[model samples]
Target: MAATFNGRLFLKNTAYLTSTGFKVILAYSRTTNFFYAYYVLRTLTAMICEGSINCLALAYVADNVLERQRTSAFGILSGIATAAFVCGTLAARFLSTALTFQVAALVSMLAAVYMRIFLEESLPNGENLTQPILKSGQDDHCQDGDLSRKAPVLKKIPSIQDIIGLLKSRVTFSQAAVVAFFNSLAEGGMQASIMYYLKARFHFSKNHYADLMLLLGIAGMASQLVFMPLLAPHVAEEKLLAIGLLGGIADALLYSVAWSNWVPYATTIFAVFIVCVPPCLRSIASKQVGPTEQGKAQGCISGIISFANIISPLIFSPLTALFLSEDAPFHFPGFSILCIGFVTMIAFFQSVLMRGPPPVSSHKISCNSLVA
Candidate 1:
């Protein structure tokens, strides 16, 4: 069943690419450099939209799948993503000379074709499609007995306040938000600074950076496939987050000392595990809610992640400047990542202590569903 869904998604992806490719081709010969820049911006915006749309997809899936199996299903999706990233990174590293961006364009074209020819809607039939209010209020109670039915007038898009209100109710969101904040802080800084670090410390070129990313991608896939699912059910989400934070911190702490040739290779391997943890935590977080709430839940989480992305870069820039010496071989991004890990670890522990176990079911969720 999961395979079929994946095939359909591939088809959809292909179809989108094919159509976009033709449009890009037509524009390429006719457009100026400024037009190309606009095109790039447009493309990036579409990518952001696609990411938001996936949150909806996860919500839809949660609605259809039973709770017992949802975690494994999410694992399957993560595994597939892991594999794709590995293939993409390896291709980028080795075949990039031959497989330019044009190759990616071609793949997209193929996916578009497949989607147009074969894809069908996966959303379950005969379910309430209406949007509902997430806030706690008697006035928000349903008119009819069908809670699955959406509110008569849906908000076209989620508002900042609406998203914030949702976060206030979910323990999972609170914890995940903290982890995301630090992880992304570390990541955004690391990404922004790594090339500089490499140039100064090891005199790495573009090719070497590509090679490193390819290796990291390999480790990411391995951890997603072999480690995450195996470890997930055994430990609660909070513990997994702590472990992930610790691993990331460990990588950072080692970075200053790992100047040897072999250290990069070894740390890159560990980085995969560090990188893979967030999605695992996400899978578990989404699972805590009922299917009816998955879409809203994911949207709320996405908002938090976006908030973190915005905050991380700003916070890291000054810190990096303050701590990193002009001539120092190693910089502060590693230490910053370590700090983020420690902060997240503390947050996770505090969250665990404050929230005990999640309630068997929230009164709000139970009552609202009943009214709907």
Candidate 2:
């Protein structure tokens, strides 16, 4: 809600600035200067807010949904977000920029209110009440007087140590983080490069970008809703992740070497599989940790993705700028995107190395029979 309000304010201020002749200078021709400082600051702030919400939401889903069904649950979440993107873009095309932002702010506020009213807390009050008592007892036993100072600190915000410990304790969790990090790294490059590429290469206007995004969102929603659920029960999450990464590699390559305008549209076929990557990785990561650690596990994954978002632009933006420039570096203009594909390839190999979770149903069945 805060992010939406802030975003609305930013858009309003930008409009005001433009109207008053203090126009924001954007370098359309260059990739290096694609992000203005104002935009970057706004993006970082928004990311911080949204990232927290996303982590919490994923954690809630993980806590509520069974292990076997988590991929589909995450996929549904992704699908809803994708659907909103499509709807929001289509709606924005008709509304004025100011009106669009206002609508966004209002929608965010409404969603918050709805959640507050309708969404039940996944963690029971008893569990939360017991945790502090356990912690306090442990702290009290550790030292005689240290409990006073340590108790206050512990009662405050939760520490990130548990989240960090996942990387050291679980091989699957670490592998999932690697896949998520590189996947996000490659995706971040695409986010930064693709729009500029489309505009420069195809003379794509606002409408064109909207149309493309709408199509991609539709494809993504279909993949998340239909394909992921259908495959999750039969195929291992690791295999699904590997398949998604492979598709991402192909998608990136297709975009990089796109000669004609139609090529970008054609790559939506690959989006069917590519969109399954994150949910698959999330399932794998969630499976590696205990039920109690879902929040911490998802938080760690979110942090890795956030870190990738920060780093990808630093690495890919310069490469994109250099290759797109008239300097005699290389003939291929799509070199940066091809590099993105290679990055995705690296993630694919990492996914390949991940050991699948052992079959749990057989053990469950055996235990049930023995109990009977």
Candidate 3:
């Protein structure tokens, strides 16, 4: 809804402030039931907000950035998020849990306040940020002018048909969506399977997971921040996407057959290349969309990713558990991880074949009008 009608900057900042405030309140809540209640409220609020700060920020990038630099900009944004993971891990290591949560909330609140005060709306000049964008379609069922005028109204929610229409409207958009799905599937499956596989094989603990995460996070940050921008224009995002998928395949393969405890940690360097997948995929998606519908297009891509994330655990978790147990099955402990690699392999091939001419947005019909 914020994507279609409201000011994205304002909505994102407000959502951040509200969510962080809820986290702060939850941190201080006295009752056990209230803790769960706080979480439930937060989830509901998230649903209402339609998307996260990350997706909204991506939409903002699509709005403000030029085509040639979009991929690099997305890489920078991704790098910052990776840096957050590194920072969060370090903070949790040093700070007490209560202090950490409070500090995180304070930082979030200040950032939100700062954005709300200073950030300009990602709308064209003269477009009111606080006002909703609406179009009055003629009512077919009403013949009277007054009734026709009264019945015409646009909904402020995303529609399934519009998303389908957008996908159908451009082959590139659809290809980008598929790339997002498979890449997310591979990443989510790896994340779900690797920890348990390591725990079973090498007897790793929470600290080991933290160390692994730190390595992955730092690698991702450096590659996206330092290397990606330099490579984006020359290589192009499509080639970058293929490169990331290839890296994912290699990472998964290594994890599946890891010989020693150090193998997993040492191989975390693969994240430096793997992190290119998302930014490149999103950069490709943004180019398939027009300036006005950047958020809507990004929303569709995000929905695909969210759906893949939901399905990934369902597919990989059972596979991991079954292979790890002493059940009558194959002896390969990293079978699930190998399957994850196959997922990336599929994405890699698809990305290699992912070719489309640039979308002609100037004459493109608006998909939102069909269902908005």
Best by TM-score: 3
lDDT of 1 by residue, 107-126 (tens): 66665666557755454332
TM-scores for all candidates: the values are 0.73, 0.77, 0.87
RMSD of 1: 6.0
Model 3 ranges with Cα > 4 A deviation = 29-31, 124-156, 359-372
Using lDDT, rank the candidates from best to worst: 3, 2, 1
Candidate 3 clashing pairs, residues 3+ apart or interchain:
none
Clash count for each candidate, listed in order shown: 10, 0, 0
Model 2 TM-score relative to the real fold: 0.77
Model 3 scores a TM of: 0.87
Q: After superposition, how far is residue 241 of candidate 1 from its true place, in Å?
A: 2.5
Best by lDDT: 3
Residue 42 of model 3, lDDT score: 79
Better of 1 and 3 by TM-score: 3
